[model samples]
Target: MLAKGKDATAKVLIVDDEPAFRLLAERFLQQQGYQVVSTASVEEAQQQLGQFDADLILLDLALPPHFDPQHTLNLVPQLASRPVIILTGHAERDLALKAISQGAWDFIAKPIDPDLLAVVVKRAVTKHQLEKELLQLRQATPVSSPLPSLAGHSAHMESIHTLVQRIAPTEVRVLVTGPSGTGKEVISKALHQLSNRADKAFVSVHCGAIPAELLESELFGYVKGAFTGADKDRQGLLKLADGGTLFLDEIGEMPLPMQVKLLRVLQEGSYYPVGGREMQHIDIRLVSATNANLPDLVRQGKFREDLYYRIKGVTMETVALDQRREDIPLLIRFFLEQLKEQQGQAFALETGAMQWFLQKQWPGNVRELKNTLESVAAIAQQGVIRLSDIQLLHLDSQGGGADTEVVDSALLGGLDEQVKALEIRLIQQALQQHGGNKSQAARTLGISRQGLLKKLERYGLSHSSADD
Candidate 1:
């Protein structure tokens, strides 16, 4: 029946041996706008409970021939914060009191009352949700007054935080490059938040998602009747970000014409709206990011060289998940805490699950990890998230080969020489793909700009060559 209501859609699990009783209970619950799952025995209930979170458990106290109520009561604490209600045909007052004393939330008389059952179920779910919300608030609310520093014990993350702090106060055009899901946007936002212009707006634009035809208008805006659908005057992202910061994601995808326009905006600090007679001036700080090679695009004439130089006044790059595999454990703990707060479940990953998560070659990077955690959290039972709980949505082990092959092929030489050769090849490939943008090249290689610079120094490949 699964009726639709904002708060009435909590999940309910009904465990009873009587087929008729189960059917009637399920139907009544469905009509009340709840998601109902029924099982004939405690064993079946336990199995199903491991994979689905139940807001309330409706337990029939009279089990089959060999079943004991005490055995069932032992499993109650296993569920993550879920409340259970007892159901039985026994009319004795002492029996009901015993059941309630054994940790049942409420006892319902068998041959259930449909209307009364619905009201009790709704009240139990409401109470559970309120308690969960209060717990989350207590966990999330900070005790200290000062804003917490963006600190990471990992050397790689520590370096990034240091770089963010150093570059935040300046108006330098920063180019942040990283593989997909490597937290480039997080770093960018942190840069904006810690900067001198923190009081102003921070506008984010995904360059790849916009169609090329509308990108110009979206960036620079348009006057009324500028095009067939343009009925009203529009303010562009650039104008909206005036006296603030504009974050350009997937900057490598910006078409050459738009690159020229972006270059002009950076150079002149002004732009004219489409079909508008006047030029508008804006004060803005630009932060750009990409996961592609920009230098190669430049070599292919797909990117503007002048624009690359202008936007990369200062540069940073994020390390890939594979390169910093040691951080996976820390990340997993952080995500689990977040999921506990978000889903109202105090679930811990099983040892096998933790090992599986650590061993995965996360090509999709941090985003893949978060998604995996979310999936596991949704299906876990007994407050234990097991390896079987996660359904691996995608396998991207193939992408790790290029970097590995490059390293292995160069290992015959001295460490310095091998590293140099590997650096040269990666730089060439990245530059050729990205059109002479070092930031973009570094992203494709899964290394920071400073790391890329160190590699460049080892290979005797100058910054001037990357710009070319």
Candidate 2:
């Protein structure tokens, strides 16, 4: 089984009897830069398979007369390493169950949204690539060594390191809680590395990002023929981390049904995959992290009480960058050194820029800091990083009111209007600074594409005209 990564390009084979459907899928995937090959029948697909390699196989269940179950089953074993995703229209419970039992990566029901189909294809590619990379890594090295440690020496981090040392040796499930961009995942990795099962897989799952329907199979694995479109078997994250750690990031966002299933696994050390009969047992450690308060979730009955208890064997909170203001210089220096080494550019941070960085309230924390430094480093023409460059980087000034109040109060009518005016000013400043790329603008704002779109809508700024 593979662990997910950010950069995994998939080679997909679309096996659909409908020529129109195949063409549509091929066009969509091609637009996304994926290598897509399509065929109208299983025989044609098999011929292509013999000549070419595919990371993922998209198999449509109802493939006319000759391509029956026996014929398809014969081809499945041949794809020992590659994953096959089933495309189907069946909604009946029995048919879905049977499909899962037959060995499908996943089944997508008919009337698929093009955007969703593209996302599924991309996910399949990523999962297959992760599995391949992990298998190779396992074969290349001894499985008993620990994962790499996080490099940091600040007092706040030292406290976290100390907590990890105390918590990692046991089989207890740990809850590493912190705000987004505060290195919660890094802390989870540290706990895994320090643990006894460090040699085994340290599987990390981003619970909130994955769609609810697919989350169960992605975590627990699914049997072939379990659903209408399942053409091949898949091993879940729990099985992949059988003897190591399973880090569930954004645990707060996991749906209620999954929380129940997860709790059962924690209690019994066993779980049934999406379409499996027997309970699969695995000895593993759980390290869950989230920015949301699980306690509050428990109060609201959004999260399970038992699951919270199971995962909270040890709880450690990561301090946000703003709270640990003294560490700003250390972090800035570290990022600067990293930039200098990576870019091979001799650069010095201007005194004014360094002062501005220290005074600014970084709501996005460490991640925001690193990104700001990176942007400045990329744009700096001279050997020196200027205060002007720092100003151009739109650090979220919503929380910078302490220092800005005097100047802001002088220029503003009311709080809401003043903030909106400031936001507009900052957006303008960022646009001028970067010569305008919406994606870059979004990054500088520490917001998403959708969020930026809404902001642009609010300001009556046409997104197309943002560059100008």
Candidate 3:
């Protein structure tokens, strides 16, 4: 069930070739007091967009004359903040989700349920108005206390900003949890910069990336002749980060012995460097992040429960990109600006292409979005990104090698199947981007070589998904 929105002055542009269906939908929309404009094709819709200010769009997924379902979907940018509701004949849930992912706010199957249609339209219209209002308020408001470099205007992000501002100055140990590629490091950096010891070093250590045997030495460097490799008195991250902040990423992967040592440091406000008898006092804040379930690990005795409680003085949970979807456009804008700076050429997106980006589900979250946009920007024609350009990026197989492109075609499959196909494709692209170097590819993809190799095998990539 959905709430009715105060949608006065909202306009809906309907793109359906069928006259009877158009008339019916027009009647339905008019009955709800919405101004309706009906178009026979995407080209007509484009023309209508120039003169009419629409707040929403109703697109027929199956259009006449070579029914490319994604035809109108690719044109969403033209509508700007307008929400699009797709009308389709299929009752399949995947198709609906895919439609929404492709930029439609919602999709209703043919022989439309009037109640459902009305509710979806109302919600979409309400959302559009709210977003517009938020944008305006942001633009009008003074930046007396500006947020960190994390770019987003969604409610979830706003809440995060408020929480960070409140908690960052405090000495409480913070635990950040989110899926991989969701900008945990960025958040950690913000925390460090906002803290009282901003002038001192903000040392970051990846618990999972460093070897277990070397992690202790890396965290608490030893004195000269302390171990085989210890040639001089080396300052560890703990010493370097003294009077500042230490961000331990992937904290769930930290070894049990290291966890004990860390718990001791947290409890006693001091630590002894490896093979050193001297106790070193510390004055630093600890910020930890992990994609793994720390509580489950604690239950399994893999992660120390006491240590978990100590680190998680306050827990900040970051929502996935899909969950906070309205922020997509802001992120896209941020990335485009970055691209312009790097390329030294201005780039603008075509409306339809921008819509596709807004609707596309980023499994790798912000990282995936950034990489995809970078690939597209690399070859955009004369600094203009067309819908076809983005489509080509999605269609590009192992590498962008051929004039005639190759798409996996697995997108037409079930959701899980599409996901698997994309994983394989991304792995191939990663390897290709790194010139078939698996280690480099692994780093680029944000996975260990072992993890990457396991995936390569899973996707049958051992037999030439890459140059090797």
**Candidate topping TM-score:** 3
Which prediction has more favorable TM-score, 1 or 2? Answer: 1
CA deviation > 4 Å runs, candidate 2: 1-155, 340-348, 382-384, 392-468
Candidate 2 residue-wise lDDT, 246-301, digit = tens: 99999999999999999889889899988899789999888899999999999999
C-alpha lDDT score of every prediction, in listed order: 0.70, 0.68, 0.73
Ranking by lDDT: 3, 1, 2
Off by over 4 Å in 1: 1-152, 344-347, 391-468
> Where does candidate 3 clash, by residue pair?
74-352, 77-351
Question: What's the lDDT for residue 24 in model 1?
Answer: 78
Tens-place lDDT per residue, model 1, 94-164, is 34334433334555665666655766677678766765675465446432211132323467777887788
TM-score of predicted structure 1: 0.54
Q: What is the C-alpha lDDT profile of model 3 across 1-468, one tens digit per residue?
A: 111224448878888889998888888788797888898887788788788777788887667665777655555433434667777775443454455444455556677767657766777777677766765654454332234257787787887788888888899999999999898888888887887878888899999999999999999988999989788888888999999999999999999999999999999989888889999998889999999999999999999999999999889988788888877767776677777788788876654455456646667898888888888888788787755566566642322222222111112111345566787888889888988887678657654343465456546767454433
Best by lDDT: 3
What CA RMSD would candidate 3 show? 17.1
Q: Name the TM-score of candidate 2.
A: 0.51
